[model samples]
Target chain A: MNKHKQVVLDRNKVLSQIQRLAEVAKTDNWQYEYDAQLDELVYGKDFMPRDSFLFNVNGEINLFISPDSSVSGIHIEYFQANYLAHNQELQPALRAITKKTIKNQRDNEAATALEIELSADAFKSLFSKDQLITVL
Target chain B: MPEQEHILKCRDCEGKLVIFHRHNYDIHKKKHPELEDTAFFPDRVRNALKYPTFTIPGNGNSVTCYYVEEFSINGIIKYTKVVLMNKPYIMANEKIHHIMTAHKVGHVQEEKYPGLKKQMYHNGNKI
Candidate 1:
């Protein structure tokens, strides 16, 4: 196959993985919506642009799966307040991390939510770094 | 139709790095007729070599970087090259290597070429 075809196939494989995660979300009652045209699966409705497709794995952790297959990757974003309150010393270091960016902020509180894009393999392993779970 | 080879060299090692390879001139000419006009072609080629753009992942677009090199075969320019530089030590820059690595991973925008982001955005979910 051509290189471009290979890329499309690889993206489809990653999309299948995300589709499995979406199935798990449905069973867990995580509150999700899927737009077939957009290929976007949003998890929470109240958040709209912010909360659209976030899967609240627990009360603390939220997962946002990007709709576009071309950029097929999972974004694991932490609720800013909850993350900082528990881990204070790590905040400065985390803030220093260049790739980590703040997203989905609201007017009510400070923009505490920070997200890091993870590769398909990393997402499959639930963002495990050095055999340690980086995000819960 | 004879095939011509083009090589893009790595500045650090000065090794012949082949980044782009094309064997058909007629198809290339059909794709880029602007390159056929010899009168103003050199200037246009110079401008293209001066401003090479690389696609940024997830941004669905490419941004021009200020580094490039042009290669010619038999007085006919074949391809342009970008030199990867080190911020500190001359050793292989990990950042550039990482970007290249990330690019290998399946995360690029769907658009085939550059400057198509506006049209893709307007299409919206259709793509």
Candidate 2:
């Protein structure tokens, strides 16, 4: 068929694989939530084959899956990079600092928690790439 | 047949090395399942962030599973002479390929969803 059609089929195949992988991961508690097509929303119009679906994992991290690997390819960006890079400088949660490091501060603690969980590469990939390809 | 003719002439080209095949893996399955076997992409992207060039299997002869079709486009500029294949590739059957095409289009659907595209591009700081 056409390239677009082929992309759609490929996405489904990837999803099926994800489903299998998720099951294999066997997380004690995991839920899958369907999201509106994000690709069309980005491309401005929808055509044959449809677009990638969205997912909110555990109320955090909106995981996107689609054939437009260009933009969709997860490359983290923004504070995520700084976070991953700077996370090492912070004193361990169980360690002692100047009676007051940013981690000890309530506001900074919350921000640090989120930052700690991400990697430099993944964080950049998430936002830097351009979203390419759109389906019906 | 369609590719054989193309291969014959390229075989005699005196310029750069003429590569006629490729190999890769199944990102989803890990199995390097044999490809259709045929000629594939002309260049390779060695970056981890990049997706990769496809590998369409060869023909009845020494064809490799290296996909050799697919172009790039960005409005005013359209590069059709190039093949959008992948490296360290994976086996994408017709069925799997179809699913992929549809899923990508789904992303296109998102572009039309209200101000979604605007929001995503501007880092959601705008919309």
Candidate 3:
């Protein structure tokens, strides 16, 4: 019979892994911020906890790591810019122009926003295999 | 002084209840004075239970409970396990619950607890 043993992680080891991830994020255009009082490490571009990223039009992803080395959650928000006609007559004028033209114009003028939360496992998987190996 | 204890019951199942013992901070502070002001203190577990960010789904009303235990580990004073028992008398997901028990030895192995459901969320939201 084989006996299975659980692997307990060292506190320092866990922190090191999180720091390594943050370092990698820096090269990926993510800024790193640490709160000593909350013991939370956050990395992302214009990221805020539980709030939508309003500053940048680029995709925003926020990763939160708690003091215990557990990942709280990852918040991802994608933003796309769209152009709207300032003149009220533009719609009617475009309709008279061509049906195909309206379709193309609508497609170009559509904005998109997506917000999602990734599970802990999914968040960890985002890290490179090399980074994960040391922590494991 | 006797340690404080709290009894939590499943809102759906009135007869089902679990007893959770509060941590003895005095004893723990003596053992690990360095963690006196940190969240690592055993009392933090109690505080987490009192002010949980989320709860487990139960039949009708939601249920809240803590499954605390103590272990002998280096540089650690105590280990507290908080379990949110839901409807059908199910326990919280092991993977998520283990977050609180990380870096410490568990006095009771998880396998010892049976017939507990996992991944049931209350209020349809999660922290």
Question: How much DockQ does model 2 earn?
Answer: 0.04
iRMSD for every model? 20.4, 14.1, 19.3
Which pairs of residues clash in candidate 3, taking residues 3 or more apart in a chain or in different chains?
Answer: B58-B87, B67-B81, B90-B117
**Stronger candidate by TM-score (1 vs 2):** 2
Best candidate, TM-score? 2
lDDT of 2 at A113: 37
Q: Candidate 3 DockQ score? A: 0.03
Please, what are the lDDT tens digits per residue for candidate 2 over residues B1-127?
0121111111111121222222111121111011111211122211100221222221111221211122433321111111111221223321101011101111121222242212111211211
Q: Report the candidate with higher DockQ, 1 versus 3.
A: 3
Candidate 1 per-residue lDDT over residues B2-121, each given as its tens digit: 223522212122221212123322322322233344632434333323343331122212222112223322332222222122222222432221011100111122232344342111
Tens digits of lDDT, candidate 2, A17-136: 333432322332221111111111111011111233332122123234444431121111112222223556432322321123343465356433332342232334333434323232
TM, chain A, every candidate: 0.26, 0.20, 0.21
Q: List the residue pairs that clash in candidate 1.
A: A42-A53, A43-A53, A47-A51, A80-A112
Better of 2 and 3 by DockQ: 2
lDDT of 3 by residue, B1-127 (tens): 2324422221211223333323422322222232344544435454434433333322122334333333333432233434442433234521111111111212222222243333322332232
Listing every candidate in turn, what is its Cα RMSD in Å to the true structure after a full C-alpha superposition?
A: 19.8, 17.9, 20.3
Model 1: which docking level applies?
A: incorrect
Give the residue spans of candidate 3 off by over 4 A.
A1-136, B1-23, B28-37, B51-108, B116-127
